[model samples]
Target: MSEVNAEIARFDLLVDAAWPAPGRAEDGGWVYRHAGGVTKRANSVLPLGERADLPEAVDRAERFYAGIGQPCVFSVGMGASPGLDDELGRRGYRLVDPTLVMTSPISGDEAAVGAAVEDRPSERWLRTWWSVDGGRHRDTGEGPARTWGERILGGVPAGYVLLEEGAVGRGVPQGRWLGIYCMAVEPHARRRGLGAAVLRTLLAWGWQCGADSAYLVVTEANGGARALYEREGFAVAGRYHYRVRS
Candidate 1:
């Protein structure tokens, strides 16, 4: 693989570790993940590396998700098995959520204001995040979905930040790389600097904990968020999208 592709593969692994699904199984080089269908990233397949029998692997992935009552989905990252995305497309999978992976070096001097960072997400932190982002995916009413979301958040050791009850974010440090996730600011809090504060706080926490670089994933359509991340020194390092069977 080329150097850029290799780096993208590395980031893919870091992202998987950062936001792990509670239920997972492997079929050849493909990983089938499910978390009660809470999020696509958790429920979809990660078709990384190479498969000796690509068609059989795809068939197995479809069956896995079908058994779990989820639409068969594949996260087609830069490191995904060659032609997997095209094969899925030919099989009538609809492409969704073209996303970008951004990265930046951590300076360790990032300042944290009133935001509070915790080892685990608090009830308030979860509620704040759900309030801002949950509605986008599903209903805000809490139950199994919320439970699954929390489980995913706690799958790995990470720093959770809450800023003035209006913003929240999570940072997982994997060696020298920090994976940032769940960045959300309340609708009413958009104009304020709460989002940046939450990000800086997470970066500072990650750097102090030994991470030298940070990365995050954001949907390409989310220009506002992309702008925020860009202003914070994050640049697009890779791209990926999901293919959902129709």
Candidate 2:
């Protein structure tokens, strides 16, 4: 709830939501799965000490991944123990991107949320988001679009995608709570207050559905986003990183 950084924030969320991969080590730490998304991280604070690879621990991760046949995403951040990077690397896993974590409470009024993404606007908005993402994500399928879309699709936790839309904007809510996972207004759509409207709609959806709190994450470097969220009344809650295996 405090304004912690991304690492701490992610750790807490993972502990609360992610399901650990089986063959958990009794010593501590675990592989987690949430909503069908699989990732590996330390649950409780564990020791990397001087010696990074503890036979039992290394073996557990390898065996678990072998069983699942999926790449276990390792979110490396502040709470991460030493040698984890090296240990996992030696085993052939790589570190991924270290994305920022951000949050804010709902604020502002008069905006509306449109539930069930409208065929025209929703597509437009998502397409813009895709464009903004550029070569970073291959949603366009020309390569960038295809690659990015696949990355996101792959990264999504199972139960979450299987359960909810995770889209928030003015006037949309299926339940008491709505998650604003990807909130992007088209560059052409910017400054028109669509973002604010989206937030309002998301809150409305939540309230209408009976949700108590609304939350989201952003990176510190995202100046425009941070400003918008701040103006809208969302405060920095914490940060977390989704370290891509290198």
Candidate 3:
């Protein structure tokens, strides 16, 4: 595979490892993921390569997700089947949440006093992660937030760094590389260098864990996050998007 394809494949692995799905299988050049009734990333089809029976594949995807009470969704990346996005578009699937995957060299920094990095997420880290990501809704409603939280935050065998009064992030290692995820700062904590601090801590941890390169994914519309990653030497290595039939 080319560099972009390799990076994107690695990113997809990281996503699967980090988010996790209780029910996962493969068919027709696609990876089907289902996690009860939680987030799209954990319950979507990943079209990785070309296949002869894409229509049957789409039907299978629809049935699989519908069996689990979820609308069908597909993750299309740079390495996905050519024209898959257009095919989905023609099938009434609308595009959503375009994301950029970025990579950079790992450079250690001084660890902050309040920063806590661990192989598993702490209670505070879990709460902070969901609060900033999309966990707050379950606070009042009868949503499956806890289940989603458990799968999203508890499945990774990687570093979970939480900075009290600062920020929170995750770093999952795959071979000599680490992929960072869930890096978030509270609204009150913005513009205080805490975001950079969270990244610095993850880099230090990745380096200590023998990682040479580190990567992270951010939505294409998140300019502040893009700027921050760029300042840390990260560049856009690949991109992906979700197409859903709701």
Model 3 lDDT, full chain set: 0.78
> How many steric clashes between backbone atoms does each model show?
0, 50, 0
Q: Judging by lDDT against the true structure, name the best candidate.
A: 1
* Of 1 and 2, the candidate ranking higher by TM-score: 1
RMSD of each: 1.9, 8.3, 2.6
Model 1: lDDT to the true structure: 0.87
Q: What is the lDDT for 130 in model 2?
A: 50
lDDT of 2 by residue, 14-65 (tens): 4333223222333355333322231233212123223344556656654564
Model 1 scores worst on lDDT over the 10 consecutive residues at: 135-144
The segments of candidate 1 whose C-alpha lies over 4 angstroms from its true place after superposition are 137-143
Which pairs of residues collide in model 3?
A: none
CA lDDT, candidate 1, residue 176: 92
Superposed on all Cα atoms, model 1 deviates from the true structure by an RMSD in Å of 1.9
Residue 9, candidate 1: Cα error in Å is: 1.3
How well does model 2 score by local distance difference test? 0.44
Write down the lDDT of every candidate, Cα atoms only.
Answer: 0.87, 0.44, 0.78
Off by over 4 Å in 2: 1-29, 32-73, 77-101, 104-110, 113-125, 138-177, 244-246
